[model samples]
Target: MTDVPAPPTPVTALLRAPRHRVSPRARLMWQVAALVEGAVAIGVLLLVDLAVDQVDLPWWGVVAAVAAVLAWVAVVPQWRYAVHRWEVTETAVHTQSGWWAQEQRIAPLSRIQTVDRAEGAVARVFGLATVTVTTASAAGALEIDGLDRARAQDLVAELTLKADAVEGDAT
Candidate 1:
């Protein structure tokens, strides 16, 4: 009997965010930065291993490696942590992200000061873009990176139109 491959896992509604989000350029940039950082970390660990070997091999070194590995149990999974999760509710945009200290941000469309998108080399290759939304709040800016450029522009236009419409209704 021919074995059929399992169907791909279906994405449930709850697991999905809005259709629009930050640009792909931004996501690519962040991902590239992460890869570079990970490489550097491995290099540092190698250096540390060499240096530690030159010194007396403390029993703690073994314990330290074990401990460090254990500690990474927490840090590693966080790399995939949702850096940006957003949804356009009727009233506002809600975002949630946190590796250690969790944070959630909400920005009403009316308060959006600017909407912009960026593209980079990776974005060019992948046809991705990033969208950033600034608000009156000094500490908060909404960025949705790693999106299709056309999609990003469409989203920006939609948000701007919505903001304008809301303003018109308020008057």
Candidate 2:
């Protein structure tokens, strides 16, 4: 008698669309700066309040700082979200982003010539980095920045391997 074959395991919904998000600290520094500015503004109000012995004009500085801080707070989440999403599929690496409008960019493995990484002051603080992929097509060099460093390196290595495989297949 022939034995029955085992059923295939189902893929996890989470892994179906694998995506890497940017480090929270990638945009936290700017938000923190906004908060500090707001605090300084409060201090300025207190000083002005003591100097004039009148409740006038000091409120305006506080109001302006609060408004600015509020605006930054409101806007940061979307920017951070946009910056975070980076994904690679079997065929291409996809970058989806934008705030007011959405943008999607795709880079095929065969076209990629080099993959590099970068780090800056804020990025270092967040332990975040950048990955730049170069292509022969010359579309002004697409760059994916503000990623966690180890993740970026792993992506680079995988893409490099895929590129080599594709090149070998072509020849």
The candidate maximizing lDDT is 2
RMSD of 2: 8.4
lDDT of 1 by residue, 68-101 (tens): 6545544543443345556676666666555467
State the C-alpha lDDT per candidate.
Answer: 0.63, 0.69
* Candidate 1 Cα lDDT to native: 0.63
List candidate 2 segments past 4 Å from native: 1-18, 27-62, 168-171
Q: Write the per-residue lDDT of candidate 2 for residues 1-171, one digit (tens) a residue.
A: 999997776654323322766666656755665566667877787777778866676567767867876887668654756554778778777775555575556777777778888886666777777888777654545566667788878878988888877753321
Tell me the TM-score of model 2. Answer: 0.62
Native-to-model Cα distance after best TM-score fit, residue 14 in candidate 2, in Å: 18
**Candidate 2, 39: how far from true, in Å?**
11
